[model samples]
Target: MNPSASQNIRPETVAKVRTGIPGFDSISEGGLPRARATLIAGTAGSAKTVFAVHYLAAGITQADEPGVFVTFEDSVADVRKNMLGFGWDIARWEKEGKWAFVDAAPDAEGPIAIVGDYDLGGLLARIEHAVKKIGAKRVSLDSLNALFVQFKDHAMLRAELFRITSTLKRMGVTVVFTGERIDEYGDVTRHGIEEFVADNVVILRNSLEEERRRRTVEILKMRGTTHQRGEFPFTLSSREGIIVIPLSQIQLTQSSSTVRITSGVKELDRMCGGGFFRDSVILASGASGTGKTLLVTQFMSGGFKAKERSLLFAFEESKDQLFRNAAAWGMDFAGMEQKERLMVVNRYPHAMAMEDHLVEMQQIIDDFKPNRVAVDSLSALERVSSLRGFREFVISLTSTLKQKETAGLFTSTSPSLLGGTSVTEKHISTLTDSIILLRYVESFGTMRRALVVLKMRGSQHDDAIREYTIDGKGMHIGDRLSAITGVLSGHTTFEGE
Candidate 1:
C-alpha cells in the first residue's frame, strides 16, 4: 500500500438532504440523496402523503428551503386540512412563499388532458413554474399512480415522469415522488415509473400480524449512497409524522459509568456489588406474589429519596393500584408524585403497537429527565406482542435508556409458580446489565420466597440464593439458605441432614 495512493483514495458517496422526519436520517446514513428523485411507495392508509408533506415541511422549518408539492391524488385544499393534525401549517408556509402547490389532482376534466400531443407538457409546465415561483429546493409529486389512472399509456407515463424528474434534478432540486404499492411486499413500482427516474427507492408497509398493526419503513435502494438495509419499525405521531425505529442500526457504543445507585433496598444493593450501575439496565424476574411490583415501587422510592426524579411506566397496574401497593409497602408514591420527584404513567398492555409505545416511553423519559426509569413487569407487554415485536421493544427500550444514561429496572413475570423463565426474560436477559431472580421454594410442605443476584456485569455480586420475606414494611432480605439446593430451579433438595 503506497502512502500517496492511500491519501488520494476516497469513499464513493452521495450528498444528502435531510428529510426532517425523525429516525429516517439515521437509517438512510444521513438523509435522502440531494438533486435526485426518490420514490416513496406504500399502500393506501400507510401515511405516504404524510411522509411527503413532512419532508417538505422539514425543509421549510429546519433549513429555510422552499418546496413545491404537486398533488396528483388529493386536492390542495384537502392536503392543507389533513396536515394540520400533524401540526404542519401548510397554509402558512404557502402564504410565506416557502411552499407552492401545483394542483395537478384531476378535476372534472381528468388532470389537464396530458396536454400537447400526449407529452405531459401542461402538468410539467405547471411543476416547472411552481419550482421557479418559490425558488424551491425540494419537490414532491405525491401519488404518481393517480396519473396512471388518467393516462392509460404505461410506457409514455414512465417516460414523461422520467423527463420531469430529469428537469427537476437539473434545477438542483431534491425530489420525492410518492407512488402506490399494489401489495405490501410486491414490486417497487406498479407502473415501473421508478425504473426510469428514481435514483433511490423507499418503501413503507403497514402489516397486520395476529390482528395487530405493525408499520415499517425500508430503504430498498440508494443508488449512489450506502444505507442500513432492513425493514425498521416505524409509527406515525400526531406531532412529528413518521418516526422510524432503527433497532438494528442503533450503535452499541454506550459509555459505562462506574457510579452506582441504590436498588431502593439496602440489602439488595449490597448483593448487587454496591448498587445498580447508573446507566445499567436491570431485569427483575419472578412469578406472581413474588414481589416484582414491590421491587419496582422500592426502586422508584429510592430514587425519590436521593432527590432524583424517577419515572415509572406501569403496564400491569393502574396508578391507583400502584399507589395503594406503595402505601402498603410503607412508601408514599402519591406524595412523591405531588412533589414532582416521581412520574408514574399507567397504560394497558394492548393499547398500541410496540413501536408506538416505544416512542411514547422515550418522549416521557426525555421530558421527565429522570434519573431512574422502571417498567413494571415487561411480561405484560410481551403477552400482547409477537415474539419479534417484543424483542424489538425490549432492545429499543434498553438502548434508549442506556443512551440517556438513565438507570432502568424492568420486571418480568415467570409462567410457573415455582421455577421457570418467561418469554420476556429470554429476549432481554443478555441486554440487561444485571439480573435479579425471585423464586418460590417448597420446603418441608411450606412455601418460601428467595431472591438472588443471578448475573451482574463489570462487578462482583453475591451469588447466594437468600430467603426474603414480605410484610407490611416491604421485603426483608435474610441469610442464605445453605442446607437447601436448587432454589432457582424451584425444586428444592436437602443437601445434608
Candidate 2:
C-alpha cells in the first residue's frame, strides 16, 4: 500500500443514512443503507437508547434528512431531554415540521396492537403522517422489546417484527430498531426473535470484568455490505457525543518519524538508542529514589527545548515543588516555561473520577496538540480509585496518545508489595507499549539503582540493566554491572574478589 494512502478518507459511493457520530461512519465503511433497517441490540446500560437517539439527531443535523422517533419506552419529551448531551435543541426541529415523535407505550399494553386492533396499520399511518407532514426520511423505534407485551407468542412477534421492519424499508425510510442481546452465555433477557428480524444487527455490550466496566461494539451482520467485524472500545461524552477510537487506524505512521523526547539526563540518552521514538509509550518503573524522576524530567525538558508542546500531570508533587527539586539538580525549569513549551497539571487523588481525569487530559491534548505527554508514576494513579477504573483511565489515556501521535512517558513505582518480579497491577504492564524497569538494589550494605529496558514495541532496545545514578549534575549511566545479582528481587549480591 502507498504510504500516503493510509490516512486517506475515500468517500463512499452509496445512497446512505449518515450517522454523524465521530469515527462511527468511517468504521461502518461509509454509512447505513439509505432505506434499510439496522438493529442495535445490547443489554441495558449498553447505551442502546443513546445510540438510537444520536442516529436520529445526526440524520436531522448532518444529512438534512427529516426524522421521526417512535418511542415504546419513554415519552417524546423524556427522550429529547436524554439527548441533551448532543447539544441538540430537538424541539426547534419539531417546531419546524421537519421532525416528529410517536408514543407506542399505550399501544404496547394489554390490547393486542399486532395486525388490525392496534397494529402495523396504525403505526404506519402515524409514521406516514409525520413523514409527509415534514418530509422525514429517517426513523428510530426506541425498542422492539415493547412489542413482546402485544405479541405474546414468539412466532407472532417474529412475524410482526418482519412486517414493521419491511414496511419501513419499503417506505424508503432508513430505520434503526433498538433491542437486547444475551451475553456470552446466550442467556438473553428474551429470545433472539428481534435479532433475526432486522437486516443488520449491531451489538453494544458493557460489562464488569476484573473490577472494571468497559464498553465495546460489534456488527453481528450487515446484509449486502462488507463491514469490519470486531468489538472495539468506545466512549460517549457530553461534548463529543459518541466516539470510537479505532485501534485499526493506529498503524505506525511516517509523520511520527521525527518526534523525540530528551533523556532527563544527556548521558542517559546515549545509553538508550537516540531519545525515545516519536508517538511511542515508555514505562519508567523503579523503587523509591532511583533517579526515575530525573530521567522523566530530562525527557520533558527535551520536548521543551525543541519547542514541542508537552503536558506534565504530576500526582507526586506540586508544580512549584517539582521546579524547586529540579533546580536543586541544576536542571533548567524556569527557562522552559518562559518559552511556552511546557505545561504542568497537578492533581490529588480524591478530586475526581479516573474517567474524568482522562476526559480533562483529552481536552488539553486536543487544544494544545502536544507532541509529548508525561504521567509521573502509574502507582499514583492506582492510589486514586478502583483498579478497574484506573485501568479504563490508562486505556483511554494511552489510546488518545496513539491517536494524536504523541510520545507518552509514564513512570511507575514498582518492586511490588511482595518484593519480587510479580506485579499486582498487571493491567498497567499489558497496556504499555514499552517497559523500562528501575530497581534500587542493596549491595554490600549500600543502595544502588539499576535501569533495564524490558519492552518496546516496533523498536529494539538494550536489554542490559546498567548501573545508574542522580547527583547535583543530574542523572548518569555507567557500563552494565555484571558483578551484581538479585536486582529484580530488590536485594543485591556481588562476586567476592
lDDT of all the models against the reference?
0.89, 0.72
Give candidate 1's error at residue 36 in angstroms: 0.5
- Tens digits of per-residue lDDT, candidate 1, 400-496, equal 9888889999999999999988878888888888899999999998899999998988899999989999999898999999989888877679987
Write the residue-wise lDDT of candidate 2 on 372-469 in tens digits: 98888677867765775676667767778877889888887765521255242366777776777777767666767777777766555677778888
- C-alpha TM-scores of all predictions: 0.96, 0.79
Clashing residue pairs, candidate 2?
264-298
TM-score (C-alpha) between model 2 and the true structure: 0.79
RMSD of each: 3.2, 5.1
